[model samples]
Target: CLGKEVGADIPFCVYQKVARVRGIGDIVEPFKLKVGYDVLLIKPKQGVDTKIAFEILDLDKCPHPDINQVKKALINNEPLKDILGNSLLYSAEKLVPEILDIIKECKERGYEDVVMTGSGSTVFVLLEKGQDCRDLIKFMEGKYPFVYRTSILIK
Candidate 1:
């Protein structure tokens, strides 16, 4: 909202499903998504500071998932378990080790498409269509304070 009020060209700052940020300062380009997936969001009690995450990030050591491949997977309706990932996962996990635990737990429960969202304690598991998340939700709820079953935005 502030960006709009200031007459800034921040197209992907809000209400965007898939966006590519370039050259910093909210310079983003929105991409069209052909499909959406069922998502299970699990946030632990701890929180990560974005600033610190960036500070601790080592570009050489961090894993960078190919954004183009992710975009192609979404557009072609292909499985993204092997393609989609966040570069900030390494730093974020450093701040909150429980993030790794969450990922491990999700995988142990048969979830393959697990990834950390942004720079933090929340990990999302992409669920296959018609997959029930109740048991997972119940399991996560027993461990964490917030466990939500939701879907990714399509538009």
Candidate 2:
């Protein structure tokens, strides 16, 4: 794993719900999710720089979701409605306005668990378990530069 090669103590290299002690290279632990969610990731031509994203972030206005609540929701397979959100979404959306349009499009299509992953332009729509996203992927591929169908890594 890159974390191990870099001398960071961590259990996994890549996965969701990963908690780092002091961010990135710090002590990291990957939390296992009970239910795997089929997801459609759509990214526009524009990309947001991670550093610039964080630099413009306003913690005062951005959401501060409870990490513990998010972890519990994932582990217990609970509905993610008010509990899951990204702190960097505000800054990312500011950098790339396409992010908002993508999210709105997803919600308009009846997908509720839409969120901007990490720092940028790529937005993901979490589908119900075992739900097929081929139609969504096909629709998104026509609009966005990059559209992919993937799932959460649940162990």
Candidate 3:
């Protein structure tokens, strides 16, 4: 409610299946890119929710950090020198507050474990009841363009 805008990209990108998460080398399954925005990380209908999907990994976001360093580390297939590059990828720093607002909203709605996915527009929220999750998203759709779907954690 702080701002009049909802996640702007959800509508167009929601139903459109984007690219899959890179790496994994075959043991893992391929997933599509259903989201990309500030503060939130959403999983479209085709895959597991990013929250659970990325949970095992030490993932995070940042205000202004060295993305190139992080990418270089990843590209070289070396264990991240700074594993928790929370501030590395910050293409949307101004959106931090927006993300926080969304997280706050999620907390207010009773979700306790909300996490930013890969420093992006997708956000995964841990839910006790899926209906509540659905309802919260439904409410947001009335306010701004958004995507809605249910997915697994690791699939």
Best by TM-score: 1
Indicate the residue-level lDDT of 55 in model 3.
Answer: 48
| Per-prediction tally of clashes | 0, 0, 11
My TM-score estimates for the predictions, one after another, are 0.84, 0.82, 0.39
Give the per-residue Cα lDDT of candidate 2 at 104: 86
RMSD for each model, in Å, please? 3.2, 3.3, 13.9
Lowest-lDDT window of 10 residues in candidate 2?
Answer: 7-16
27-145 per-residue lDDT for model 2 (tens digits): 56666676677888899999998889989999999889887887788678888767778889899888899999998888777787888876777898888778866767777888899
Comparing 1 and 2 on TM-score, the stronger one? 1
lDDT string, candidate 1, 31-149, tens digits:
87676678899999999988899999999998899988877887778888888789999999989999999999998988888999767779999886568878888899999998988
lDDT against the true structure, per candidate, is 0.82, 0.77, 0.42
The sequence of per-residue lDDT tens digits that candidate 3 reaches over residues 80-113 is: 3244233312332233334445555666876555
- Native RMSD of candidate 2 (Å): 3.3
**Candidate 2: what lDDT?**
0.77
- Which is the winner by TM-score between candidate 2 and candidate 3? 2
Tell me the lDDT of model 3 at 119: 42
Candidate 3 error regions (>4 Å): 1-96, 128-131, 153-155
Query: Which sections of candidate 1 miss by over 4 Å?
Result: 1-13, 21-25
